[model samples]
Target: MQETPLCLRVGHFLPYSMSDLNTTDFTNPSTFILVGIPGLEAAHIWISIPFCAMYVIAVLGNFSILFIVRREPSLHGPMFYFLCMLAVTDLVMSTTTIPKMLSIFWFNSREISFSACLTQMYFIHCFSTMESGILVAMAFDRYVAICNPRRHSTILTNSVVAKIGLAVVLRSGILALPYPFLTRRWPYCRTNIIPHFCCGHIAVVKLACADIRINSYYGQFDLFSVIGMDVFFIAMSYTQILRAIFCLPTKDARLKTFGTCISHVCTILVLYIPELFFSLMYRFGHNVPLHFLVLIPSVFHPVPPVLHPIIYGVRTKQIRGRLLQLFTHKEI
Candidate 1:
């Protein structure tokens, strides 16, 4: 008998046959396979346990912040409003990737449609940009409350806060608009395997067979323009805040004023430190192991969401008091 064709023999074992792999539609693949983390497939189950716990904490903590902020009148201030925005951004950011990521890890369901992959990529970047903008707003709130206390309320009026929130949303949406379009325009003739839990813009773009100079350049430009500008503004705001804090005559007064900013500083550090590391690793750490490269984004994305509410809840007096009251009331 004649030997069976390789495509026919393997057709039952794979989604695509050997022949189909060679003839896959370059410009429009039906689906892309996410390999989670390369070289760590055997440990996906173990890896997912902490991730799942973090996701649960992130969801509950952010929701609790939102609910407490909404219900408690004492927490109604410009800073708290900004905190609400931050909570919502964190919730959406984590939600956008974690569920699908869990599905991949638990069920080995890694195939994501091209359009769906692009949508995930867009939401991840958009919310990340929004989170950075929200942090800047929080820093500005702290600066005004400290350095310009006389006009803090007037400067960050309800109307002004609403306008700032609108601006952040519009800026993030517009800046992130180009990412999906840029990635889509390229023809992806290479293998459809993306070695990540979610569709990262650079990860997806690298799979394209065409030259991706524009994609790479735009990614750099977008990262620097948004994150760089936000960081600069936050630093300037804090510098002014510190100067104002030191001008207070009493040591206790200076400490009291500075205490107000500790939470914001902590929040900024948690967000930017990991983000900077992830960006640098991707751009320059060519010698870094593939698993490390994949794990960084996985850790950074959900970690801030899990930590932000805890930081705010514990550090902000009104939030902490209200939380204690809430739990105590439950006990009674």
Candidate 2:
């Protein structure tokens, strides 16, 4: 082996300290190596700049949304509540991938333990799935508010919102449990290198020695079915919403509903468009460069959390007024 440089920053990827001997053998558990920016190691420093910016903004943006929503009583409606949930899931998804991603780009640390990788894989998938689930719920909230304005409050009470939140958490978390558990049982006899900064389901499966047809099929099925259902419901809700708006007697009413939906449409595009593209590319595009491929989804991962409140909170009259009023009063 070539003598490593003094700045050879290759170390196991984790917050805690572990010996260099940590590996898959009788002495230690399995370790999957993360290949960070192969053939373009020179650009890792420049690559992390925007990624770190996005991560910090996402965390701060989501935290601020949670705080502002809790502080103001006027923002206690179901739509905002579901927006809060979306912010939370975005935070989880970003956090699951970004810190280690930054580590790989900054310090060149890319080794991750098997158990830790599995946990990371679980949460990364889980929270993303949860985001879509919450979006569907948000669509239901909008549908009720627009279609049956009189019964909106009656149908979507605080209890109902809480239930929807719980259901989103459970569905995303529980259904994703099997993939990690089963993947662990497989014999990963091939080289342990994962060609990404973080643990992804398809990446991890590709490293296994045993047949992964079951896991692949199950993952794809679960991905499409659970997330597909959410997409279907969201589409139907919007369709009904449009129907209700058109049935109104005045063009002003239709415009009003259109204005209300702008933020939601933007949010949906930010959350799903990149995600769907990532899923499809992983399934079919073997020729794609890992550096470019990873960059695409990683860039979009934080867009929703960082932009949601800016779009929804800043544009919504009540929330904007309250935020401005708070700042003005505090300045005194």
TM-score of each: 0.92, 0.88
Q: What lDDT score goes with residue 123 in model 1?
A: 94
Clashing pairs in 1: none
- Candidate 1 residues lying further than 4 Å off, grouped into runs, are 1-23, 330-332
lDDT of 2 by residue, 130-179 (tens): 88898899889889989898999999999999999999999999988987
TM for candidate 1 is 0.92
Candidate 2 TM-score to native? 0.88
Off by over 4 Å in 2: 1-29, 326-332
lDDT winner? 1
How far residue 250's Cα lies from its native spot in candidate 1, in Å, is 1.2
State in Å the error of residue 31, model 1.
1.0
